[model samples]
Target: MKKLTLFASAFLLSLGSYAQQALWGGTNLVSPQINEDKTVTFRIHAPKASKVEIEGDFLPPTKVDTPFGPQDIPSRAPFKEGKNGVWEYTSSVLPSELYSYSLYVNDLKMPDPNNVYQNRDIATMTNIFLIGGGQADNYMVQEVPHGTVAKVWYSSPGLGMEARRMTVYTPAGYESSKKKYPVLYLLHGAGGDENAWTELGRAAQILDNLIAQGKAEPMIVVMPNGNGAQEAAPGEAPNSMVKPSFMNPKTMDGAIEKAFPDVMKYIEKNYRVYTDKNHRAIAGLSMGGFHSLYISAYYPNKFGYVGLFSAATSKQVNKGVTSDVYENLEDKLAVQFKNAPKLYWIGIGKTDFLYKDNMDFRKILDNNGYKYTYMETDGGHIWKNWRIYLTEFVPLLFK
Candidate 1:
């Protein structure tokens, strides 16, 4: 019995020693520690890595002059390594906002493994952190009455798609109340899916907060997957990750325009949405803005309010289009304006690369005598400006 006990003890000691070695050799790191002063500190455990760097929208914008125009890119900072192969960088005091960041270990970029809150924009994914108590605080989930965000699968026979998915946001009291609410079809930009509005744009929180404060009317927000070739976001769709070329700008081929009617049909059939032009609104960012423009023009009498944020305008639409659609663009605009939407709003950043394009489109509107509300703010083509556009635009809707 003594010999047996000694053997068991020896085995246990060996196991414990192995565990200690593993713990010492491996890295268990906590990242994006939000300091009390609103400065954020990021950490990475890459002991043998030659270099580490952090890049994010939280840093100052880097201005670069491009052939088309001046462009503002997100700033990047190098991280200093400390004891035990840990690298760290603390940012200056930043405004209240949601920021996405990624780390580069040597030359490979990756999200912080410690942070479960991450967002995928286009082809890249990064860790996200929120700094609270300002305009950005509105973006955070708060104690206010919340809304229900549903990931729904519906059939779109018109687009030849059977199992498409979209996200629907119903305001608080939607289930309890029998009253029908106005609908806002919120579209996502290129490379973004239905999840973009809620996950990255913080649409739910913005609507919830605005509605709770009585600043805006309670409305149903529909976020549809604008990519026609795919059913939903990356992992949500079958073979989506593998065949994402459907999302490529070259292949999109005005699929969103063709598939829009199906989106409306699904929403009107399933939800308690008001079925009137006056109560219906459409808005989008970037490529979505182009979709909004084309959709509003294609079915001018359908939507009462139209908003375009940092829109890709006529320049993009006129590319390689010899169809009747391109031929009658101006005539279609005339007809669209004749219907007279309640609000035809355009919002863009002054420094946005698309600024000249937007200005050119505005000139066309000006020459045609079509009335529109144009808002230009600081910053470039970033979510920061898009969020501001949403906040200011929603209050003016459904009035």
Candidate 2:
């Protein structure tokens, strides 16, 4: 009986040693490992999961033969399960870009546990990875003089909201320099708050790289919460996770438009900003674009530069216009043109769903004899396009 007991102990020790050796000798299991040729390999450990799939913007485009010709569709693929609960997938060579992805484990989407870099778009969160080179390198943080981004709270009497939050970016030498700097009121799209630009858009990195390269001027950027009802993002709000009302045109009526004065008042009172319209610029993506257009038009001569990136031109005026505020939008735009901004710029992607609306709005600008520059590029209404638009638009401001 003693000899049998000793034999059992020896057998258990050998099994434990083999298990440790197998784990230590295997690959390190690094998720999102960028290859020499720009392809990426992603891995996740989910031993209990029945199936896993990887979906992201970095996947190679699928070519579908359409009536018009071949159309490229975004792709998602299943991850192959390997030994010891490891699931892995290798992507085809992708363009140099910042991509967001999530794993579908047992059909439930979740951010990658292995990837530390994550981004929040509205309520959904996803993992992010960058394939660097070309324009994408600009999005990455580099060895350059950086700016300070602050989340600030201020009074908004205009909207009858006592306090609100905004994200402000001051240039590298702003604190040291005695000279006042130009201000750009940057706005985000629907379902987004002031944090959108800095998070998904990588606004700070872009600004730092641009200023370092002398591609953009040294200026301050103010990103205000476009949703009038919500003071800040999800957890930062007075009541955590307040439903965003920016999507409802009726809810926005007189809210954001009236609150503009308060936002400017708070900024002017606290920050050293250029007071004139020439040094004042306003721009936004999607819904924010619509706001910028109307705000600039409503208060003609207030903004010298106006940029719209895939703006919701179709819904410029609310469906039910009981008040005369937006009744004479055309006249307002005419007056705005008469005042003449230094730069009236419009940028839209070729495949954007709002392309038709943007074109129709351009006709109105044409009819009013408005002088503006138009830029068309690839891709649809995505953050990638917005970031590109921002990089292009900033270089033209404060010139």
Candidate 3:
């Protein structure tokens, strides 16, 4: 047994060493240093492969006009191969957001020889590189003013999952300080898990930037599993049912009161979080936004701030406002209508499918005497819109 352990350790050490060497090899992986013009280049030495393409998040499917010239959505950017079969391409202009991309070697997905910063959402992870002026820090992993992110597990009797692990971002100064930061419960959309916001939304970076700018108040952000199912991270299409499991109000309610409480209690006991109404907020996108509406409106005392980004709410439909409608709806919206929270923020893109929803919600707010801020931008349901929303919303928080 001792010999086997030593051999395994030695094998891992050798693989690490080999990986480092491959990174340093001049011909294989070449990190194309991006220029001031935001133009970046890639060089892949795949001489054995008949075809090679460079894929990245620099442009949209229709807007792809790189050296490869107009490829499909998530298409391979063509590379000009050399005498030794080394392929290369130069980008038009890359954005500032972190990107994940890879090489398609004869239709097989593979990592870029030159690129680094590889991460995984599930077992199927991707590889890509960062192209920006100064990305010395992994902004996504940086600490929020009042929190630290820790991966944890909680038992869910309702879902029948023995113990489900999830990620939580505890605010900074949580330890050693008697002060408790407000809790901001965030949820991901469909086809995403608890790690979605931390991974792709760049929530930590947005909080850090907002806190630095003195726009947002320091707070704890909790990301929990929204699906009331055994599947931790399901695919785009969930299992077909006579009626979707998620549509069951009893199941969602049970999950919220039971599984959600398990996560909450764990956080409250383990971290320094406030236990008051003013110090708690809830927000999400898509399905997550639906959860926020149900949870927050039902338990209004728990959250002092509520946000809906491209929300999917029945209350938000393009119907003209009237006093009779307002009277009948005030009770459903919860709260005293006039004095609900510190802020009720709704954000949507003009081009987004939820644009009319935002407008309708604003009308409802106007009719019911409820107060809110409706932020409209030029984007869609993609990460671009979400990131922009975070940039605008975080600054308005904790004030």
TM-scores for the candidates? 0.88, 0.87, 0.73
Task: Give the range of the ten consecutive residues with the poorest summed lDDT in model 3.
Answer: 317-326
RMSD list, candidates in order: 4.0, 6.9, 7.6
Tell me the TM-score of model 3. Answer: 0.73
Where is model 3 more than 4 Å wrong at Cα?
A: 1-28, 63-76, 119-124, 131-147, 155-162, 231-254, 257-262, 315-330, 334-338, 356-363
Measured by TM-score, the strongest candidate is 1
Write one digit per residue (lDDT tens) for candidate 1, span 1-399.
Answer: 999999999987888787865545445666889999988888887899999989999877788888657798877899999998888999999888888888888979888866778876776778898888888877988899999999999898856878999999999999999999999999988778899899889999999999999999999999988877677888787776553432454223555675688888889998999888999999999888988988888888899999999998863644775434334667888999998899999999988888888999899899999999999999888888898899989999989
Model 2 scores a TM of: 0.87
C-alpha lDDT of all candidate models, in order? 0.85, 0.85, 0.65
Candidate 1 TM-score over all chains jointly:
0.88
- Ten contiguous residues minimizing lDDT sum, candidate 2: 243-252
Q: lDDT tens string, model 3, 281-312?
A: 78888667756766666555677788888776
Instruction: Tell me which of candidates 1 and 3 scores higher on lDDT.
Output: 1
Candidate 1 regions off by >4 Å?
Answer: 1-30, 64-70, 243-255, 315-318
The residue pairs that clash in candidate 1, if any, are none
lDDT of 2 by residue, 177-260 (tens): 888999999999988888999999999999999999999999999999988777678788765755444364323474686568
